[model samples]
Target: MKTMKMIAIPAAVLALAGCATTPGPDELRTNAIAMMKASFKERGQAKLDRIDQDDMQRLCSEYVGEKVMPKEIAQSLEKAQQALIKYPADGKLLGDWKLGERIAQSGVGKQYSDDPKKPAGGNCYACHQLTKEEVSYGTIGPSLYNFAKVRGYGEQIQRYAYGKVYNSQAFSACSSMPRFGHAGILTEEQLRHVVALLMSPDSPVNK
Candidate 1:
């Protein structure tokens, strides 16, 4: 049953993609805009323009389901993404590890039913094994257990983790991880907390 669901989803997506008949890039975008406008109705804070793509998104979509892009294009994309990361203004890289755990475990907020004023979750556990006790973690990303110990708790690792969480595309051009900080899904405070979870020796991830 689970396997059937997975196949069905891809089939549905392919069907939808086939429905897009526009021949050129500009026309394809126009058709996509029209399709979105016709299929969805604005409700709460979910605007129709939300379906619109950013430059990176458009570039990535152009190669959807195909082989990997050229190395030059991939490097160019990663470089652009790295430039978009925003560190905390206070120069502090770590925060409460406890708070970070909560954010990492949570998968709430950002849905149409969610309150926009409230902070969204990092939902890290959905893609990475964060600790020994988290038996329910997904395997989409590499296990992050002992992240600090294995990588060594240092300035470089701290910066790398923070930047990767901020904009994963900087490290992996086709990473499935969401650009939490880059997309404004989480604030600097929240980002710091999450970073602490992955970097602090005291955090469960390190243990």
Candidate 2:
């Protein structure tokens, strides 16, 4: 009985030691990505490549649901994203605010069911309170109500707004906001409209 007890004790200790061994970050990441790729199917505009992450995206994914990214890493990622932003050639930032409002309210685009020929929407309301009349707005992003009034309706501010809508990650790394222009989700004209919606003095957003 004593000999049997000694053997069982070592066996139990070995089992516990094995259980304590945690997978390394790279191993965990590889397993997770492989599982995701295996689970999802490509459909329409949504291809398998969409699951693949770029350098910044992979970095962000590694930190997500685990811990906040280090400040240096975040800043580095933001700098890389900012470098990719493309401004208009005509130097005009603002567009028709009325059309901008429509684009802001729309949530249609980039889905498998969506018609590729049709213009995609900014869907700003999905993450922001753009107008006072909008009773239903998401809290995921900050409110832009009276944006121009508070931020000042200037060329600089307009340019900033346009760039942010184009690539939110340029300003905030790993931001939940989509990179509309960077991802080709919105056209240059559509981006201008969205910018106008936020920066126009006469727009409902400013009121």
How many clashing residue pairs appear in each of the predictions shown? 0, 0
Q: What is the TM-score of each candidate against the true structure?
A: 0.84, 0.88
Residue-level lDDT tens digits of model 2 in 1-207: 999999999999999998997999898878988999999988887788888788888788878775989999999889999888899999988888999999999999778888888898888888899899999889999998999999899888988898898899989999999999999988898888889888887899988
Candidate 1 TM-score, true structure as reference: 0.84
Best by TM-score: 2
lDDT of 1 by residue, 111-198 (tens): 7788999999999999999999989989999999999999999999999999999999999887789999988888999999999999
The lDDT for every candidate, in the order shown, is 0.91, 0.89
RMSD after Cα superposition, model 2: 2.6
How much is 188 displaced in model 2, in angstroms?
0.5
User: How well does candidate 2 match the true structure in TM-score terms?
Assistant: 0.88
User: Candidate 2: worst 10 consecutive residues by lDDT?
Assistant: 57-66
Candidate 2 overall lDDT versus native:
0.89
Query: In model 2, what are the clashing residue pairs, if there are any?
Result: none
Q: What global local distance difference test value does model 1 have?
A: 0.91
